[model samples]
Target: MLMVTLLSIACCCGCPAYFGKPMWEQYPATASLPAQVADLSLRTDARSENTIRELRTDVQNAHLLADDTFAGVYATRQGKTATVFGTTGFHLTPESDAEDELTRLTSKYDLGEQQVVETDVRGEHQRCAVGRSDGVDVVVCTWADHGSLASGVFTRLSLADSATLLGTLRKHIVSRD
Candidate 1:
């Protein structure tokens, strides 16, 4: 019995402690699932220029930018990268900050690190967080839905790209003003 207990403990603490397919498998891509917010457009705002510039630089520097029609940004830094979704208006409402919300959601999943990096996406504000499993990092970005607007938009990047982009984002990106 003692041996079994010790073995169980060791096993639990072993690398990749839990047995399961990679996160990509669990959260299958919904590529074919029509765009949920394809028709939404951001409310126009002057502050959006700064937001877009920051997001563009970050995505470009990290090299994770994808050519999507939605006019969002994606980038990788220090082996980490993330995707951002913004409407034409470029504003993320107060309710759309999912960083805080994700911290709570991840708690139930045994994922680690609920630290969220809050920033403005284009003119749309956004929240980001990093989660780790089996020593791999998972980064998620969500755009908060403003009043009368949708709740928010979310996207994620693989651990490798996430780490790289996160590294670059932290070193090169600033959210002042």
Candidate 2:
């Protein structure tokens, strides 16, 4: 019994060391892009009552901005009357200053009531803010991890819902390899 217990403990502790860093840590592409569109969890359901009507991926445009960037937009509909748009992007900039970017966005959009929050995203830090732009409610979430930056802008959803959705979407941008 003693030998068996010791062996189990050794194996448990050795596994992680043998595996090295996670895939996200080792590759910028994996860490910066979502594995799939469905991973964003932006779909209609009985509870959400929101059906995705259109999905667009702009890989070429994203590549124009940066060699390692992924961008997408989703348009969702509610019944026949309401439509909402959400956009997400992962940009890899070796010298990105997350704070400066946040400041620029806040200034351009006139964001209000900004709050710094902890995020599951593998980043140095995350910031979230809510505001109104052109008579529409908007939520912006930004985070920087190493040289990669991730951000999401959500509209037509409640502030609380926007935050929740942004968080869920950010969590899905993981290393698939």
Candidate 3:
């Protein structure tokens, strides 16, 4: 299944996420692109070399501008595998952009019977969905705003957990560029 393949591709690094601060605690929100994304610069191993290469290629081939910033992070945390790719650019229609991103994932992976998860993050428009691929549960989420758009594929995490993690990661990700 496409989702499984992506999960494997994303399970490249095994570093833990920084959960010291409360995931729900709201910090100041900025409407600018990110200078760096957490978990994206982890060290890699032989098992992850091909995966990293493929993910980088895919992100480069994505519909981002020549000067826009991009990153595809493969990380495993608390036994869950997440492969996320995000790009920074200007887009006013976050709602439509979020939907279009979900549509892209729906077509990219065989996610049957997708269920939408409502995610409300300040200063960002986000859409999340839960589905199954190859009998393995997968949660796909995307968030977009005036400055950035990003998507991720997660496995073995509950819908709520998935949404929360992405929301938490956004705090460390989006910053003035």
Candidate number of the best lDDT: 3
Report every candidate's CA lDDT: 0.34, 0.48, 0.61
- For model 1, the superposed segments whose C-alpha errors exceed 4 Å read 1-97, 108-123, 133-135, 147-177
- The order of the candidates by TM-score, greatest first, is 3, 2, 1
For residues 65-166, what per-residue lDDT tens digits would candidate 1 score against the true structure?
A: 222112233332332223332222222333343444444436433445543444432222334444554354455534332211111112245433443343
Better of 1 and 3 by lDDT: 3
157: Cα error in model 3, Å: 0.5
For model 3, name the residue pairs that clash. none
Model 3 Cα shift for residue 170 (angstroms): 1.5
Candidate 1 C-alpha error for residue 135, in Å: 6.3
Candidate 3: which stretches are off by over 4 Å? Answer: 1-43, 74-78, 112-123, 133-135
lDDT of 3 at 81: 63
Q: Which candidate wins on TM-score?
A: 3
**Alpha-carbon shift of residue 58 in model 1 (angstroms):** 31
